[model samples]
Target: MKARITVMRTVGAAVMAGALAWGVVTGAQTDTPPQDASVEAVADAAPGYAVEDYNYPQADKILAEKNIVLKRGDGHIVLADCASETGLLEVWARSRDKICFKVTGNSGWLTLEIPSVYGVKGSADQTAQVDMTVGSEEKSFDVAKNSFAAVGESADEQGRDYMLVEIRTAK
Candidate 1:
C-alpha cells in the first residue's frame, strides 16, 4: 500500500509539472501582439492613465512584452480617474498587480486606487485596514491621509507573486 501511494504521488507531481509547462508556453503565446505595430498602437490599448508618465520600469517591460498598454501620469494617481479613463480596472493578475499613484485634485476628495480584481477590501473612510498575502507572507497596512500602500513581494525579493493595494480616504 505504501509503494502504491508513492507511485500515485509521483504521477500527480508529474501531471502538475506538465500543466505548468503548458501554461508557460501557451499562456505566453496568446499575450504577444503583432510585430509590425508601432509603440503608439501598443500604448493606445493599455489601461490606466497615460503610458508615458507612469514610471514603473519593470512593469513597463512586462506590459510591453505582453503587448499591453498602461496609462500613467506624473502628479496625481487617482483610482477614480483610472477607473473612469480606462473603464476596465480589473484586468491584471493578482501576482503582478501594484497600485502606483500621486495625490491630486481636491484636498479632501481622494481616489482610492487598487487592482479591480481585488476590489475595495475595507471602508472608504479615513482609517481603513486590510489583510493580504503575497506568497507565504501576510501583512496589513492602514489607509490614511491619502497615501499609497501596496501589498506584494518585491520583484527583486520574490521572482513574481500576488499583491494587494488598499487605498483609504482622509477624514
Candidate 2:
C-alpha cells in the first residue's frame, strides 16, 4: 500500500513539471515580431510636444479687419473695445481715430505699429510708457495714470510723425 502511495505522489509531481515545461515552451515558441511592431506603431502615432511662442493670436485676421498690426505680447495687455470699459488705455493716431487696450497683472508689454501716433490716454490703474520712432530716431514718453499725455508729433519739437512701436505699463 505504501509503495502505491509513493508511486501516486511521484506521478502527480511529474505531471505538474511537464505542464510547466510545456507552458514555457509554448510561450517561447510564439513570435515576438508582431508585439514589437505594435509597440513601434504606437510610438509613431504619439503626438508631438506643445510650445508657446508668446505671439498674439489672430494677428493677421485683426490686421486685415481692423488694420491693427499686433505682434507679440506677454498677454497681460490686450486690445479692447473703446466703449467696453472706461479705464482702458486710449491711443490716438492720425491713421486711426482711437484705439484702446486693457492692461492687467503687475506689469505688461505689447509690440505693435500705429503710424502717426500723437497722443495717449492713460488707464486709471496703471502708468504707461510708449515707444515711438520717426525715420531712424526713437523716442519714449511716460503717460501718467488717468491722464492724457502728448506724444510723437504733439510732443516732438520738430513735429515729425512718429510710428508707435511698443507700449509698456505697470500698476
Candidate 3:
C-alpha cells in the first residue's frame, strides 16, 4: 500500500510538470500583442516625401545683389567675384562690363541674361560655347580655351547688339 501511494504521487507530479511546460511554450508563441486602431493611426503621422525642381537657389537675391538674371543650371557653373580667383570664364558686355563664372566638374551649363555681350574670355582648361540672340535670330560662338573671342556685335557684320543667354563648357 505504501509503494502504490508513492508511485501515484510521482505520476501526478510528472503530469503537472508536463502541463506547466506546455503552457509556458504556448504563452511564449503568442506573446505578440494584438494590433489596435492606435497602431494604424501612427502610420498617418509620418512625414511626407521630398522632391527636387533644380531651379537656381537664391536667384532673386543674386539678381538684386549683382544685377544678373540667373535662370537655371546643372549646378556646375556659378557666378563669382571677378577678383576672387584666376581661370574663370570672363563675359564682356556693354552694360555689365566683365562678369566671371567658375566652372567645375567634367562639364556644365548655365542659362542667364546679359545684354550687349560682345566678347568672352574662356577658362584655361575647358572650351566654351556661348549662345546669343538678337530679335528673333539666334547665334552661337565657340570660345577656345584661355583665349578671348569676339561675339555679338563685334562678330556680326551689321553690328547688331546681342543678348548673351547661355553658356556650355567641357573639359
Candidate 4:
C-alpha cells in the first residue's frame, strides 16, 4: 500500500511540474500589454512618418525626400541597409542641411548617424553644434542626441561631409 501511495505522489508532482512549465512558455509567447490608444491615434494621423516597408527605392526615396544620404563614403550605410534587408521602418529628417534619422525594428537594433563638419564637441550630456550645406541650402543645428544641423549656406568647410550614427537594440 505504501509503495502505491509513493508512486501516486511522484506522478502528481510530475504532472504539476509539466503544467507549470507549459504555463511559463505560453505566457512568454503572449502579446505584450496594449499601448496607449491616444499614442496609436496620433501615430495613425501621421502616415508620412510611418515605416511600413523597407525595400530599396521606397526606402531610398523616403530618406532622400528628407535630404538624407546613407552610405555616403564606404563601409555600410549603418541602419539603412539593415533596415531594408530586415524589413524594418525608419524616418529621416534634415534640419539646417544636417541629417537626423531614427529607426524602429521588429527585432534587433535601430541606428542613427549624423555627420559633423567640425566634429562633435563636449560630452553626451553637453550640446554639439555643426555647420554644413546641402546643395544651395545653408544651415546649422545643435545636436542633443545623434543629430546634425547646418551652420549656414556655405560650402562644406572641409569640402567633405561627416556623419554620426547611433544604434539601439529593441526588446
The model with the greatest lDDT is 2
lDDT of each: 0.42, 0.93, 0.91, 0.41
lDDT of 3: 0.91
Q: Write model 4 residue lDDT over 1-171, tens digit each, in one string.
A: 999999999999999999999999887686665576333456567555775443333346656775444423222123334233332222222344323222332222223334443332222222433334555555544544333323332235554444433333222
The residue-by-residue lDDT of candidate 3 on 1-171, one tens digit each, is 999999999999999999999999887687466776233567678888886665778999989988888898998888888899899999998956599999888998999999999999998889999999999999999999899999999999999999999999999
TM-score, candidate number 1: 0.24
Candidate 2: regions farther than 4 A off: 1-48
lDDT of 1 by residue, 35-131 (tens): 9865566766877775464443455564556433333333232432233432211223354443333334332222222232232222232433433
The 10-residue segment with the lowest total lDDT in model 4: 71-80
Angstrom error of the Cα, residue 28, model 1: value is 78
State model 2's lDDT. 0.93
- Candidate of highest TM-score: 2
The alpha-carbon deviation from the true structure for residue 20 of candidate 1, after best TM-score superposition, in angstroms, is 84
Candidate 2 lDDT, 1-171, residue by residue in tens:
999999999999999999999999888687567644644567668798888898998999999999999999999889999999799999999956699999999899999999999999989899999999999998999999899999999998899999999999998
What is the full ranking by lDDT, best candidate first? 2, 3, 1, 4
